[model samples]
Target: MDRLEAMAMLVSSVEEGSLSAAARKLNIPVATLTRNVNDLEALVGTRLLIRTTRKLALTDVGAEYVATAKRILEEVDELERRAAGEFTTPRGELVVASPVQVARLRVLPVVNQFLALYPEIRIRLVQSDRIIDLVDVHADVAIRVGRLRDSSLVATRVGALRVVTVASPTLLDKYGWPETPEDLRELPCVVFDSPSLSPWRYRSQDTGQIYTIADVPRLLVSSPDAAVDAAIDGIGVTFILEHDVHEAVIAGKLKYILQDFEIEPIPVHVVYLSRAAMPAKLRRFIDYAVPKLRELLAEFGRIPSA
Candidate 1:
């Protein structure tokens, strides 16, 4: 058996979750994928995967091997790029991942401009709110907001985002504006359910104290887009990144409130896995993208009354 080919098949199988899925991604027959994995297990003298009727599970050893195989593949790709003098040309596929709402509202337009400038470079945008494993997902770069706990990855702060309390004009007319954080409990509120079960958090600008709303939400949503829509329809007040709701607020679909007690600005970052030798394509893309993203944020921040 070709050891490298078997290793590739094994990694693909693990990532794709089944031999059939790996075969589909690799453009090979399922039988061939299965055979390669079996050969790989035999050579290693251990079963790498625990096969079940429904899905494949990796053994502890299999998990370790997968990590190693991924690094090996990345190194091999880097070597090939170096051999082809990719460092100078800035031409290759660049895969980026970001939250869907942010990508649609902020990054997509900038991406279009980037593409127009560098026609030779190909781009793939992956929209997901969940934190993706950069290496395993084959993502060249990621745009993230809020506090980053992953110390393993290299991060560059591109800009900051402020959490704004927003509601519709109709809701404000009926319920009246909240004068303080304590007043929020008396009004209906929309809450995002993903990060935490709690309601909006804020700091007292006068007393320099932090507080959280423990009141039950009139509506709970799992996505920011849903929260924004609910607020636009006057369902309830919600908290979202100012950049995400700026346009709606400007158009009178939504209105901003509680400016004095606004949540602290969260840093937006562009993150990537560290390597001794970085690909020119990835480097060029970041260099071109970061400044533009910062400029976009600055422009948004200057929008009066948003």
Candidate 2:
């Protein structure tokens, strides 16, 4: 049996969750994949997987073996890429993950310009508000906001985003300005139902105490853009990242309020897995894109009104 080929099949099957799915991805027959995995188990002297109608579950031994196999496969891939001059030449597909709004407003423009500059590099931009696992998705890099807790990943902070409270000028005229955090009780609020920013948090400038406002929302929406629109239509006040309301604020559709109560700026970052032999494509994109993003955030992403 070709040990490396069998290892590759086993890893693919484990990741893809089924032999048939892995076979399809590897472009081989399902029977062929099964044979390779069975042969591998026979050679290793243990059953590696618990095959089921719904899915494949790894045995304790199988899990350990698969982890080692992945590392070996990655080392081999790196060696092959180095041999093929990919380390010297910046040419390959690069997968980048980012938040939806950041990608739409900031990262997309940089990606467009990067593609024109580096003709050989291709990028797959994955936009999501939820956190994406780099290893699970095989992403080359990601744009991240807020604090990062993953010790395994490396991060380079580009800039910061402020969380600001805003309302339509019309809404403010009716409700009047919120002079203190306690004053929000009198006004209607549009809540963007994200766990990170929910309950409407604020920081005191004088006392330095953090406050949470838990009053019932006038409008509840899953998306930040929807909440911003609702706020602009004079529905209610919404607290969101400056990136979401920057344009609307400039156009006079929205106005910043409770400026003293806003929290510290949330840091934005370019992140990736720690690699010993980082690919040239990944390196080039980071080098090219980081400065452009920093400039964008510095000029536009900062708290504009104050």
Candidate 3:
């Protein structure tokens, strides 16, 4: 039997909780995976897994073996990478997660350029508005906007984005622009349904005072794209990151109001799980990404109306 292959299959089966799922991930037949695992058990002279019709459970011995196997595999991988000069060279798959709008408008373009420069490195991007559990999902890095909760993760500030109130030109023409935050109470407000929308917090940089607009509608949506579409259709005034609507504003499709009131600039960060030592892939990515992100933010800052 291929002991290393069997060990890999065993680990995958344990993590996936089923032979079928392991097969799918490993790109092997279910029967082949089962046979390899059985061979591994026989070679070790012990039953590693307790199998039932409905479920698979690991024996106490299996749990111990799995931990050792994982460590061995990781070490072997590290050795191979070093042998290949990857310890000094950044090459391999880098999985990243970020919100949809940020991915589309900012990250994708930069990633495209990065890929062009480093053809050996592969990038997998997962875009969603919901927060993803990095460890559970096996994401190498994440780009997050706004305030972050306390965690063991390491975060580097990339830039900041302002939340802008925007509406279609026609809608603004009809409803008229509000001079003060209180005037927004009468106008149709497009509310983003995310947790960030709660209390509608704003602060004045000049006065150092905080204000929040309350009693807003609960027209919650999952994505900024949907919210922008709603605004473009004249549904209501919606709040979004200025980068998201900069093009629309320039095109005269969207207009901003309440510019004098200081909405706090939400900090953007590139976050990764803390490790004893940063791997080459992570370090190289940060080195490459930081400067590009700074340039992008500077470009956004120079936008005429942003």
* Candidate achieving the largest TM-score: 1
Question: TM-scores of the models, in the given order?
Answer: 0.92, 0.87, 0.77
Model 3: worst 10 consecutive residues (lDDT sum):
297-306
lDDT values for all models: 0.83, 0.90, 0.80
By lDDT, the candidates rank as 2, 1, 3
lDDT by residue for model 2 (189-268), tens: 99998756777889988889897988899999988899999999999999898889988998999998988788888899
Give the residue spans of candidate 3 off by over 4 A.
1-19, 34-76, 195-199, 204-207, 214-218, 302-306
Report how far off residue 216 is in candidate 1 (Å): 2.3
**Regions of model 2 farther than 4 Å from truth:** 215-219, 301-306
- Report how far off residue 178 is in candidate 1 (Å): 1.0
Q: State model 2's lDDT.
A: 0.90
lDDT of 3 by residue, 81-136 (tens): 77887667778888889887888887888788878888788999998777777865
Itemize residue pairs with steric clashes in candidate 1. Answer: none
Predicted candidate 1 versus true structure: per-residue lDDT over 1-306, tens digit per residue: 888888899888888888899999999999998998999899999999999989999999988988898878877877888888777777888899987777987789878888898878899999877777787679989998778888988999898877888889899899988888788788888887744224578888878777887888889888888888999888898887887688798898988788878766778899998877777778888898899888887766634443
Clash tally, candidates in order: 0, 0, 1
Give the CA lDDT, 0 to 100, for residue 303 in model 2: 46
How many residue pairs clash in model 1?
0
How well does candidate 1 score on lDDT at residue 79?
Answer: 86
